[model samples]
Target: MIDWLNSTALTVFGVGTTWAEVLGFVTGLLNVWLLIRQHVLNWPLGILNVLLLMVVFGTAGLYADMGLQVVYVILGLYGWWAWLYGGAGRSELVVRTTTRAEWLGLAVAGVLLTGGLWLFLDRMTGSTVPLADALTTALSLLATYGQTRKLVESWWLWIAGDLIYIPLYGYKDLWLTAILYVAFLTLCVLGLRAWRKAIG
Candidate 1:
């Protein structure tokens, strides 16, 4: 299965897109689509998407991104339960805005964590795009945490990360994944709009 998934799916603009990228693209789209509608199933779907992308990123030497997929799985589990029960009286979670304190803490954590990961990826790994990768990773972590809490601001963080990710994936010659991030950018915008309304 691993070998098959790593094999070329098609050649597009001289880039040999892999089956893993193709499958990840589909699951990733559905995962985000479901999340926008506040569905619990997005968690399992997202886990699958990240696992496939782990292979893609590992091949591309995007170590931070490959590692990010591992963390996403952990966060996905928490998010799954959060959506189902992390609410008043262990009920379903609802959309909410981040408090000022939460915003400040997330900002600080993003900066600090990005620095730490960037340093590690720079010195401890062969990651040429460590800073870019680390920045996106931090943003993704913040976004995922906020999303798990049903925070409306999570989509904004995803938007920021997607902006960087599109070009990064393109630079890595992962054309399909670049396109996936473009789709993610669009979905993040729509999700933000939808969640804003859901806050009421």
Candidate 2:
């Protein structure tokens, strides 16, 4: 069964379907769905998704992305705890808008991180899409942090990252992953609206 699934190639997209990719895709979908509903389960599901994708990205030569998954695991754990206890008086976290100062700080951090990763990948690795990979990684880190804080602006950062990720994943021939990002883009829009309503 595993071999059959791993060897099966989708004729339409010419991308081979693997068990890791399938698992990653399924968990990725569930993670975003839970996130849209603001369920605490999203964090645990996200941890599984990232672990599965680590294999996918590692094979596809997306070193930065593979590394990003490691970060996602740590962030996922943090988010799980934060959502349950990082609120006022150890209550559930609530949706909120990012302050101007917070936004400025995050923007600066993202720029510096992107630049640093770009340089590292360019000099130290054989990454095919270093800049795009670095940019998405940096934005995703910020987005995940925002999500942990239950900030509505996290969806905005995710929207931006997904826009870049779709084409980049496609270029790497990870068609299913690219399609997942398209779904992510849609979910980001929905999540933004949902969080806004919650905040108001």
Candidate 3:
């Protein structure tokens, strides 16, 4: 039984999938688990997950995603510091709702950024599903920034991005990643509820 189970594990994490992505998914799960509890340690673990993803995306030639990993690194650092010293008296950041103007800005920015990235990828790079990919990618960036600031609206953006991302990753032949995004979608919903309750 042990041998058989080991073989199955090997096959699942075999030739197509690398150890880095597996580790990445594990760290991502851990990060989210901590995040749900509003733990500061989540930021560091999240950074580790992004680092692993950076390697995975680079190997897959998903340039936009690979580049996003770099951005994640910077954001992770900022988030770490901000969460540590971005509240009253420079304390931990807390959840906040988007103001009317912020909502308008996020909507307009999400659309404009998505359109711009689509054009850039479609015209400049030989990207498959360039428009769809770019749109999700751009919005995810906005979402990530929002999350760092502990904004409740980040959950909504994540939901939208992950909804599109699951299919995109699947279409890209990244089966494991597609699965990860599915989990992310669920967590986004949970995070929203959790943050709302905390804020209220």
Candidate 4:
């Protein structure tokens, strides 16, 4: 299994793709599916998915996305705990909507973080798509945080981020990841509808 995962399977846009990317793609699909179902198991599966993707993005020289995987690990753990006990009297968290003030704060923070990360990546790292990666990374942070809070609006942020991620990953030759984001975009739409119904 380990040998197969490390072995090159196909060439995509002059880039050799391995079974590792396939594994990451499968687990990523599972993670998003679980999230849409509001299942707590998504966290552990997400952790595994991100670990695989850390290698994928790192090798692709998408430094910002590589680092985003690390953040996802931390956020996954936090979301796990929050979903289980970060509710009233230690109950499971329920779906909720963000307030206008909260949305404004998130917007400000997203812009600032995207700018900072973009500068850092463009100046310090050998990143090929710094601006796009930084923008998606910043928005993903907000989306993940909102997911932890069980906010219905997080899916919207995810949809926005995934829109950029599809082309970015495709340009980076992470075709599996790009395809995964396409699936993620569809899932985000369904997730938003489901969460909205839950809130209603």
Candidate 5:
């Protein structure tokens, strides 16, 4: 498993892309596509996406992002059940907007969590891009949590995170991963629109 995670699958432009990255790319795209359509299968695919990404990020010394994937594992399990039985009277979840209180809370948490994670990842580890990693880590948690609850704001959070993530992954020389985030950014826009329409 470790050997395969570290094995190069192919090259993009000129950089050798690892098998973990190659597979994460496929699963990540399908996971988000399913989420946009409110498919129950998104959760399971999301679990697979994060597992593969955990390897990719860890190899890059992106400890925060690697840790974020671990958290996603837990969230993925909860999200799976939530989607099916988390609504009122244990029904399928419906699309909804974040309440004002939830919005304010998420804003405050994103800021604080980024600051704290930046400090920890910088001081405690060898992460070269602690600030960017921390920022995306915070947004990712917020987005994933909101998505589990079927909140419309989740797609907004994903778009915000991807805008930061594209450059971060590229600067790290993870070309294929960077390109995947580009697609994710586009998918997030479509997701936001689709979810908004669902609420209406």
Candidate 6:
């Protein structure tokens, strides 16, 4: 079993890509788990996740995703501060539902942005599955924004995007990242359950 494990690790490393994918995966899980508990630590762990992923995705030629990692770092910093003090009278952020208008706006924006990102990725780059990959990437951005604001509906967006991401990452031959997203999907469900109970 040890030899088999060593062989697998060697094969993965022989591909000449960074092994930070595994590290980012573990930290990403920690980040989301903290998110479910409404802990501020999630943001710092999330920052680490994105910082590591920026390297992993950049090496894999996922430029849009690489850029998303950079954006996530910025948002993670903002989110860290916001969750700490952006609430009523500088209190902790509270879970809140999006308004109907906000929900509708997000839906429309997801569709438009998905299409736009797909076109941009396809026309501008040599990325594989640019359309599908970009669609998931775009929606995930909106979802992440909603999460940082403590929106109760963010889990829904995360679930949707992560569902799409599983196959996309699988297609990209990042089995570890694909599995990480599958775990993310499960956490999204748990996040929904936890946040709903906490908010009420």
Best by lDDT: 1
Candidate 4 lDDT, 92-116, residue by residue in tens = 9999999999999999999999999
lDDT of each: 0.95, 0.91, 0.81, 0.91, 0.95, 0.84
TM-scores for candidates 1 onward, in order:
0.98, 0.95, 0.89, 0.94, 0.98, 0.90
Write model 6 residue lDDT over 1-200, tens digit each, in one string. Answer: 22222232323423422357777788999999999999999999999898887777776778789888888998899899999999999988899989999888888888888888888889998888887778878777888889889998899989988988898877777778888999999999999999889878
Error of 4 at 21 (Å): 1.1
Q: Which stretches of candidate 5 lie over 4 Å from their true place?
A: none
Question: What does candidate 5's lDDT look like per residue over 76-192, in tens digits?
Answer: 999999999999999988999899999999999999999999999999999999999999999999999999999998998999999999999999999999999999999999999
Superposition TM-score, candidate 6 onto the true structure: 0.90
**What TM-score does model 5 achieve against the real structure?**
0.98
Least well predicted 10-residue stretch by lDDT in candidate 3? 2-11
lDDT of 5 at 134: 97
**Which 10-residue span in candidate 4 carries the lowest summed lDDT?**
1-10
For model 4, the stretches where C-alpha displacement exceeds 4 angstroms are: 1-6, 11-15
Q: Candidate 1 vs candidate 5: which has greater lDDT?
A: 1
Error of 2 at 192 (Å): 0.4
Ranking by TM-score: 1, 5, 2, 4, 6, 3
Pairs that collide, model 5: none
Per-residue lDDT value at 157 in model 1: 97
Model 2 lDDT per residue over 1-200, tens place: 43444454453287686677777888999999999999999999899899888888888899999999999999999999999999999999999999999999999999999999999999999998889999999999999999999999999999999999999988988888889899889989999999999998
Q: Where does model 3 exceed 4 Å of error? A: 1-15
Write candidate 1's Cα lDDT for 70-117 as tens digits.
999999999999999999999999999999999999999999999999
In terms of lDDT, which candidate is stronger, 4 or 5?
5
- On lDDT, who's better, 1 or 4? 1
